[model samples]
Target chain A: MHSALRFIALDWGSTRLRAYCCELTPQQELVLLAQASGPGVVKIVGTFSDVLQQVIAPFVKQYGELPIFMAGQISSSIGWFETPYLNCPVTPQAILHSVCERISGQQSLYIMSGLRYQNPSGDNDTMRGEELQLLGLLRRYPQYLHGQHLVCLPGTHCKWVLLDNGYVSWFKSAITGELFDVLLQHSILLPKPATLYTDDWATFTAGCQRALTFPNESIVHALFSVRTKQLFDAYTASNARSYLSGLLIGADVGSILHDTKVESLPTGSIILIGSGALQQAYATALTQANQQSVLITEQEVVLAGFAAVANQTLLPLSCQA
Target chain B: MHSALRFIALDWGSTRLRAYCCELTPQQELVLLAQASGPGVVKIVGTFSDVLQQVIAPFVKQYGELPIFMAGQISSSIGWFETPYLNCPVTPQAILHSVCERISGQQSLYIMSGLRYQNPSGDNDTMRGEELQLLGLLRRYPQYLHGQHLVCLPGTHCKWVLLDNGYVSWFKSAITGELFDVLLQHSILLPKPATLYTDDWATFTAGCQRALTFPNESIVHALFSVRTKQLFDAYTASNARSYLSGLLIGADVGSILHDTKVESLPTGSIILIGSGALQQAYATALTQANQQSVLITEQEVVLAGFAAVANQTLLPLSCQA
Candidate 1:
């Protein structure tokens, strides 16, 4: 039987810290054992070593001197050490150099490198923890990404990446969800529903279509139509929520997808990495914009991604040789 | 001089107020005398009579038992009382009924009626003070309204109205200026400019074009480009300001006039209202959207509108009969 071995991985983001313990069976099935998390490395102010020691103390107490892998903002400019942003066209070796080094530790540790790419416009894009998930998803479903694929990782600034040949070729970020919050709460035409998202969400979906179809239509006007329609007794406040939702989603999709050659992207084949409201909103937009669909949850992808990075750490001959 | 004018017509809106003192000179100029505004009728709160008593007391003291002509939100539902929304396809008589009979003490008051029209799809539209202004502008520049004239009233919600046959037909409002404020301040794009609008604001005008030309582009993506462009040394703060300005104004124009086929409204002619910032912004949009242009300030046209409404209050014997 192949050696029953354990692996551990850590993900530290702008606002989170997580550590997990896992093992690969002789049959190569990955199983999670224990996991722990604390406030992110960036959020806590202290010596980098102290942060690392404090966070790992719980796991260390149970499993002494374990192999561990780390990724995320802990490797950013203000984190443990300034791991300078890796420029485009970086290799695995170059990426290794981009990881944080020099920590006085008693056990084994491997740091994952962020991915970077240069666009034809000489622009650059990079990612760390989430990129690992893409690799894992690709490894598991290789054929799904062989052709140019559109992968959307939705969040604060939702990143939409186009993967060509297993590498991130180009990507754009849209603050669609963020803007929705502002427009809904802060803007003048805030159509705050007396109620939350209701059953008649189709009105919102239709508003999205209006926005998408007519990129130049006055969203303000469309927005006030929610009020006037309600006032004039043609629409209800319940409908207001959907109208506002549709307007925002429609506007976002219309504006973003307008420049793209819409026919080129295969419908219903999108890869989405998001959770909660953002995922649903993006899915709605994708359905509207491409008449196709993409729905990939961030939680699932993030865990799988952490595992994939851990899988790389097992090849010690490459990193420590 | 004859009776030295027993009354003045006060037309108050989002910005300034116009008081058309109704008296006669050898050459009738409907002399517009004094104007002092603490707050508009829509802005002040209290009993309708108290607000009117306090606001008009000063003006009433100056002109004594002066007949007053009122309109706009003064007749709105939340105002003194419910001057029910007459809706669109409204006639001059419908407006008189929409006004409160006792708007100003015992003095007879007549509030001008706004224009309301329902589109073929049953979509409704209305305008407040602009109708009177259009009435006056047409009275003065009749030909201007007949041959495809587009009048723009810049405010919190900018209105673009198309006038023909001495009637205010259809209008659309754009929240361009307000969007600029939110996008510039609250958005993740950039902090508000250290200063107010610059004297040379070509950048803002250019922004309008971008909005008009690329209405369907993801505003969030467009926003990121602003920062990235700034970071990569491609855009200066001025350019950033310009891009934002262009974006909003462009969006306004794009929303109002993109491929929209109405029955031949002249592109070059535009009427602008509001104070300086709005004036400049309107000028910029007109220049870009029309390629050829002329801007008629609200000051010039609004007074004419006030005068027109004042003259109409006399009521020809033919109508009374």
Candidate 2:
């Protein structure tokens, strides 16, 4: 067998699960061997063990008895195995150390721990798989390790993390994506047979501007505009959908800009971790909020994160073996 | 037939349909003859006409062929018939004039038009049944007819209306109730088998304070605290629900307090129109925002509105007859 360290990395969230077969090179480089996906933790029909077994079967056949590192909702109570949440100001090493391990069949599985943050007012906030992404970001861009930085992970529960000198200090989570989905599907904002959202940048920008203009007002009041604009024939259903997206993303980004703590930070470009349409949408919103943003794909960060974990744990073990 | 002018008043909304057999006396008194309710326009299984017939069967048996004055979602496109929305700075008489008339079977049905308001920024807002509530409030409290007053009708789409000398000068709709329901039922904030929301005023008040404290922030950020508090064992599932309610209601009221236009108005006790728990909740939130609120039942205001319509349209025709 080759001396290179090998392991499987899993990004299992609420709706989707992705498994990456990875190898750590001699020169401390991480390369993806193969990747596969299945239903997420929530979408799994059978037992989690059964779903995990099936998802990792192909990877196991090629690389027998490899250690598997799982992230995302797969570490929550409803996930495969519940893991502890490490309190912030947490480090990537602290997160790796807190990982819960169990042997499933013949494979060693490690579930990553999430981070919990308490604001000054004593309100608690949390994130799971995204911590790995933040860690990956830190690994990729070491410059952030010595300075204060802001990283936003936009997803079902969009997260805004404060990275201070390499520690995940404090973070806030916004239910932007979930709220948009719920409002479009369930609230009166959308017409019957939900309108398919198109990439109408003009309409989206207008929504962002509206949200930014009323930075102090609750979005609940502004959301009705979605329905009203459609009712008045001022917006197409598709445009309305896009506008709703813009409103939510705008509000999310706007709040961060309006945040006194965030405002106090050195006006640095926010590190946005995500890809495709959502990332673009957030970037547009951040620009509207007059904040600069740097984009990093989810795949890149998650891979870098798993590689960090692999280098810390598997490399040493493989060398010893 | 009796000389008194008689009509059937309908408060048909999305979830429930209410019909009042009403008589306008010679002395201009509105008397409730009888009342019945059925599934709302959206809940009707077969047809709208069929549902209306079933809901008003008893009222019809007692009052004979009376003109039906319908308000609420019954005037929307999805209702029995779509009525035009009167432009804002609208009065009760203006709304009555725009009523769309149709004969369903043997009943003379008059579906009241909703009111549409366009703010200075050209954003449009429309309200259907709540306009009747506002008109009713105007009739019940004529003092509001000559001065600036803010009237809040809290419901699924809570309406914050500005009345300038009895004209509904402008208004805003916040999806507070709808958002609360949707988030509790569909969002990750709640656990599976959804937490039953109970009235825990202390926890609720805490939530209200939090929202009011950060009046400028989007609630999407605050909402995740509901899950975190529960996860941390700091809040029970029930208390979390109450806190969620407080946050939404606080945000709604906070926006009004923070609104420059609303702030410029002479200080007066805001008139609150609704009944039961929602009204009480809003009153509490208003109090938390340090604003005084005067309460009126929804039934009283809606009935008054229908009476105003009957006095304007039905009484004159009956006198001629």
Highest DockQ: give the candidate number.
2
lDDT of 2 by residue, B1-321 (tens): 436788899999877898899988878788999999988766679988888778888877776777888999887977778888889888866865766778877667888888899888888999999988877787788888898999899988899989998788988889898899888888778776854557899889988999998886789999988888788856887888999999999999999788887988999999998889899999999998889999988999899989888778776576677
Residue A31 lDDT, candidate 2, scale 0-100: 83
In the order shown, the candidates' DockQ scores are: 0.29, 0.81
- State how far residue B118 of model 1 sits from its true place (Å): 3.3
Best by TM-score: 2
- The residue-by-residue lDDT of candidate 1 on B159-224, one tens digit each, is 777655544556776665556666666664564446563433655555566565666664555555
lDDT by residue (A181-255, candidate 2, tens digit) is 888888767776844557799989999999988886679899999998888857887889889998999999988
Error of 2 at B178 (Å): 0.9
The second chain of candidate 2 has a TM-score of 0.94
Model 1 agreement with the true structure over A270-316: per-residue lDDT tens digits: 68777776577768877877656567666555666655555444645
RMSD of 1: 6.3
For model 2, the local distance difference test gives: 0.86
For all candidates in order, the CA lDDT equals: 0.59, 0.86
Task: Tell me the docking grade of candidate 2.
Answer: high
